[model samples]
Target: MTDTVTLSLADLTARVETIFRRAGMNAAQTRALTSVIVAGERDACKSHGIYRIEGALRTVKAGKVNPLAEPVLDAGEGTAIVRVDAKGGFANPAFELGLPVLAARARELGLAALVINDCTHFSALWPEVEAVTAQGLSAMVMCPSYATVAPTGGNKPLLGTNPFAFGWPRADAPPYVFDFATSVAARGEIELHRRAGKPLPEGWAIDADGNPTTDPEAALEGAMLPFGGHKGAAIGTMIELLAAIMIGDLTSPEVLDYLGTTTLAPFHGELILAFDPARFAAGRPGNPLARAEVLFEAIVGQGARLPSQRRFAARKISESQGVTLTAAEIAGLDRLTAQGLDAVA
Candidate 1:
């Protein structure tokens, strides 16, 4: 038997879709979830890839998320704010339902904000960022996770990892993009390390006693530190304010309280801001897109790599050569497909 198997993206998507469908997810949930999961695999973002399937299934089985949710969009006509109520479903479909209206509002008013409420959130923000960028708009996306990180100068977990992402549209290339958690690393990375029987890197987290630790289990029981100390902590706080509080959704602490366990996916809100660069740069000295290319060239000339370059490279390879999964991963997929929700604890 082979140690690994390579499947075309379509095949992988079909398989993932089947798993979700069999797990009782409705078409909207399954399709949106599958898109983000497959995109994560295609971009080689393993933490956000198929590895997230069980958590989602568990959320559904626990009745914490509505698998049959059909997102509702409020165009917020005549305003710069668009809203989507996820109806207690996953955030992906909510974002999708609001994207077109958000783009339209941004083009008309130079900027717009899409607020996604009452949803369970997983997956990376880059997919949403890229979606906006593809519509010829710059994007900033952020959302709060379950409380798993410590605020600077604090010992206990009080803040979410709080992922934030930005994307700038480009005329002849992939958009310039960066996505990262305010924590030293994403909570999912620690979970992955634990599953793989590997210790986390130093400084990633602290033990319950507030001492630095590399043990993934201890980290899970303890608190993850903010990246860049106070700065990351501040950013995390900002996400809690804008994505959760301002959106009138549950903050990280509230989310954790509501779910009662970190084992399930987070139920919160998301903030996506879209900007039409051309509109913002109207009557400027040079074309905004052209100026951006020049800036990119200068940055590359300095030998500093741009963010998401590696992901885009991996995506190119996956598009042409297909995605490869280890035998163990394939077996896991088989088990999930066969057992559906029973595949998870």
Candidate 2:
């Protein structure tokens, strides 16, 4: 629990893998889950951080996730979609595996799209965006899950925050990474605050009966409002149709049969699109990321930084200082691991 407990990232992952296997996950599952979780902690996306250790173990135990499903790729012509076979709720591996398929297709066509059905949310979209950004491509990621909110003007819990994220490659700066959940707040974030026994921040959520409340427990029963009001709701709805129905066969046929399924797991339906900006703007590619940072720095009278810039730095810091796990989260991890180890033993 000490902040000074310096476990090499590789060593910590190895231990996580071994513990999972001892708890009944196969090697493939171990690799898939650990790789994603470690990346979250190392990248300092604390919300998606090691805190997920317990929830994942629960999904694995409740038969909500497959611990050994591997990816199988299929290709015919213009595009390729990878079926994650996450088994249940394990999606990080599928996301990792699906990247290259989309990247390769992008390399061939300059514009490529991939739909990842049936994988878990796996925390943040940054990890996936960073990979594509590193390859000099711009990416858009959209995903849907169980209903977590009513449409902005309504309260019915009929839609998920259904996150949408965008990343643009930069020549002189960190990737122009922008990620935000469509809801007022991410469910994982709400859960984190709940676990910490903290009150929900104002405007983040409403009670189950549609009344606004800052009580974490009530917020869980209620819905997270959309960010841009109707605008945010509209975007989430558009993404739902695109991510869930189009690729899901629930809407557009052109994208339907592209993946053969509409949903993946209990709450996961994801769509990712990537393009070489050269397709949009010819000569003199603009450095929007750099320019934005400069303008913001001038306004705030501080040094410049961008979205993924902080994460890039945090990743390095982790290499030097090691990942930090709050004592409470570590305890949660220990408890979750003990249950899994007992379940199959």
Task: Report per-prediction Cα RMSD to one decimal.
Answer: 1.6, 5.4
C-alpha lDDT of candidate 1 relative to the true structure:
0.95
Candidate 1: where is the Cα deviation over 4 Å?
191-202, 214-217
Query: What is the C-alpha lDDT profile of model 2 across 238-321, one tens digit per residue?
Result: 977988787652222222223222232343557778886655454565754555556656844765545566777888888887
Query: Once model 1 is optimally superposed onto the true structure by TM-score, how far is the C-alpha of residue 184 displaced, in angstroms?
Result: 0.8
Question: What is each predicted model's overall lDDT from 0 to 1?
Answer: 0.95, 0.68
Please report how far candidate 2 places residue 116 from its true position, in Å. Answer: 1.4
